[model samples]
Target: MSHRQYAVTHTDIEKLNARLLSISLSRDERDWQSVFHTHHFTELFFVVSGEGNFLFREKLYHIKTGDLVIIPPYMEHTEQSIPDTPLEYYVIGVDGISFQPAGEQTCVQVFCNVSNKALVEEIFSQMLYEMRNPAYGSDKICQDLLEILILRIIRSQHVIPVPIASTYMTKECARIKEYLDSNYSEPITLDTLTDLTHMNKYYMAHSFAKYTGKSPIQYLNDRRMQAACTLLRDTDHSISAISASVGFSSQSYFTQAFRKKYGMTPIRYRQSQAGDDAANGS
Candidate 1:
């Protein structure tokens, strides 16, 4: 008997230092509202079914089933569904790493018409299942799955994984930014942020401004303005109602802020958007 033996060689794999933060599946039956928001960690958005548009960096990208979008930290984005088709998807939040596609300077990437749809869907489904039903080693399993998912994405999309350095100021500023994103409609003040973060108000303000190039209140107002623009374009809500809905106590104040930001009154801005939509036959 003639037999040939092949020697096996060890391969070194780079360690991936990352943490799985959260995972959730969204469906149309829940009637969820989409709002412009930002996170301090990377977000993996997978379209499971239906059609919609993803708003990122003030541009809208059409998305449908089997699309995958990777949004880096501190990127403002939102997703809205087509009225008839609606949207069903999964959003997974991961920290400590971001992706940069080959030859691209930006960290955000979108892979449309993913060839391995079934495999991707199965992985997300398993991750969701493990999250909802936790037993021994479930956390480990989820972490491993997250790594596998990221590896698959890198391999298929030709993206590079860049490690993020978590620092004290980064964490503190991220906490403050997240709070502003989530509670923009609520009454907020420096005292509120101080209570929430346990940091001195002055130092927190300075650090946050250094991190985001805007004060905490400026960021909050920006968030509110983004939400107001969305409402003005999509809903028939009056200016006063929209103002209140977006955390402005008075319509006049909201209009004044809106004019300062857009160089036009709120009504004029809405009319301009309407005209553009009509011109495009949308």
Candidate 2:
């Protein structure tokens, strides 16, 4: 894979949509061959297991488990499996993205030996599941994930790594934030945080607010509300379901908190977003 980097603008991302033409989960265990072919739209080719070679425009590239190959539109390519090992892979084709090749002429680009193959696989799995079931805003969800996949491919190249906060969190606050980030979908309480971190409630709350500019419970609720917004905009799940899924004790309480924060009911917020989607032809 060449370091053929290209700039992605906000417009490019805004043009994104997940109206996939087709997606396939295939396992090629034995030797298999395919004639050179091209696609009308872009593709994300992920190798889940086995070994193989991908022939892009007659240049052979060694491929195996954990390889992610991006094939731009009309990029002639074919694949074959190793004699004993098959190529288990997913093929996702999508429309409405703009790509420009980086320096040097290259037939294909690859993100190999990916560290987050499972995450990639899970995103694709969820997308395919949603596609088959046709949930509300499912295409948007998948498209958003496709954008993530693109970002992952760029990240695997080691150009630069995103930075995390270097500011110290008084041990307890950091622990609480980590817990809330992972378990915000589950019940949380001051007692839970205090017991888990072995800190007094008053101290924990004070430290968390000091470091993060919000109380521990407020931060947890913020996370839950963020997740709820996504669900409400993307899924047809009832407001009550969204409430419980994000760890709200009750639908009524969830509504109250949501309105207090966003200044509108959950249903109203969702409907507003839906109208925006329709207006934008999304």
Top TM-score hit: 1
Whole-structure CA lDDT of model 2: 0.74
TM-scores vs. true structure, each candidate: 0.62, 0.46
Q: Give lDDT for model 1.
A: 0.86
For all candidates in order, the CA lDDT equals 0.86, 0.74
Candidate with the greatest lDDT versus the true structure: 1
Model 2, 134-166: lDDT tens per residue?
Answer: 878987787777778766665565322111122
- Please, what are the lDDT tens digits per residue for candidate 1 over residues 133-247? 9999999999999999988887788888877652223777888888888899999999999999899999999988865668999989998998899899998899999999889
Ten residues in sequence with the least summed lDDT for candidate 2: 159-168
Where is the poorest 10-residue window by lDDT in model 1? Answer: 162-171
User: Positional deviation of 220 in candidate 1, in angstroms?
Assistant: 13
Residue pairs of candidate 2 with colliding backbone atoms: 28-86, 29-86
